[model samples]
Target: MEMNGSNSNLQSDNKQEAVKNPGDETSGSTAQDESWMKLVNLQLLSNELECLICSSLIFDPLTLPCGHSFCRICLTRAFDFALKCPTCRAAVYMDPLSHPTSVALKALTQQLFPE
Candidate 1:
């Protein structure tokens, strides 16, 4: 009976030691997983900031003849004075009613500003 009690006590001590160990592999893996998740979340958030006009993410976006971006419809609406580039104020042919939204920009906008 005495021998059995001693063995049981040793097993309990081992369990406690295992619990106290800070360098356990399970804890290390959990920490790494958390870091990875944070990185993924940041990456996902970076997809926002799409231009409202083109409905796409702005990439090498040019300023329109109206001092607005080609992606913004406000520039296109100013074509009544003459078809002109919004940013440069240069004379150019543009159909005010033909403004089209960029699909890529739309997707990026949705990602950045969901709903």
Candidate 2:
């Protein structure tokens, strides 16, 4: 009798392939898990961006006219004699700050920089 191909070798190859790429079910579960984690991270960021001072989501957040906003009062305290936005190094007057905050941006930030 002569063996044209080694049965053990074929079996080994199959096993290796399977290990490299698991079945559809396993791959699907991994994908689902990744999606779930992404969503959770988004939620966390949303919660965080909610202004700690206002206890509400930041809206038209002033760039501190000092680049930092704090529910109005926070910005006022951060203000220096020159009246410059602390964060952006921009000049600001007594004028109120205003800028739009986006839910999408918050989510993206969470996704890109997951803690």
Candidate 3:
């Protein structure tokens, strides 16, 4: 059975070669998709978190009592004309001029869109 022995040895060598050079193997695409999805998710977050008035990535983000958010400077300038939530148009004349900064969202923006 010399031929059979030679065939087995050839098969073993092929298996060893495949194991040594695994980078040529085709892996599942989930890893690639995951990276792509991460980029898309970051883009979506950047879009959603942008200031509605300035249409830019939010800086010094402040949240109104009505849950609308804007940059602190934008809100102040808008209030000079009319005191209302820029997005929702909820009257905020009675509320304090100084709104609380959205700590979490601001931190996230800083992380995603760093200088």
Candidate 4:
């Protein structure tokens, strides 16, 4: 199977478009809506970006042939003995650490969780 590039459940930030309520003040309502949406979106992002091994936000993300994403450090530790994916049981190479960082995922995660 072909190893695909980064995939994210959060998808895109541009999709957030606030609906204007009839007779509502555009300035105040829009601002409040934006703040609310941001908080909600951040929460959605936090759920999707966790590393399976660490059970926290991912850093130095790496994508494996099985299409699983994980922290590079986590993958290193998990692959210490087995040459397979921990989640799917798909066989991976022993030296999976040599793979390049998942640049698209790294950028997306950093953008959402920049604290």
lDDT of 1 by residue, 9-103 (tens): 98888767766874676333476777998888766654335444454555433444454444444544456555666446577655544545545
> Candidate 4's residue-wise lDDT over 1-115, tens digit each?
1223222322332133223343456324566777998999888888788888898998999988888889999999998878789789899874656789989999999888786
Candidate 3: tens digits of C-alpha lDDT, residues 49-110: 98998999988988888887888888888888788887888898543355567899899899
TM-score for each prediction? Answer: 0.34, 0.37, 0.67, 0.67
lDDT of each: 0.56, 0.56, 0.81, 0.78
**How many steric clashes between backbone atoms does each model show?**
16, 5, 0, 0
Better of 2 and 4 by TM-score: 4
Task: Output the better candidate (2/4) by lDDT.
Answer: 4
lDDT of 1 at 96: 45
Q: Which ten residues in a row have the lowest lDDT in candidate 2?
A: 59-68
Q: After superposition, how far is residue 93 of candidate 1 from its true place, in Å?
A: 1.5
Worst 10 residues of 3 by lDDT: 21-30
Model 2, residue 45: distance off in Å is 2.6
After superposition, the stretches of candidate 2 with alpha carbons farther than 4 Å from their true spots are: 1-24, 28-40, 43-60, 64-70, 97-115
Candidate 3 local lDDT, residue 2? 100
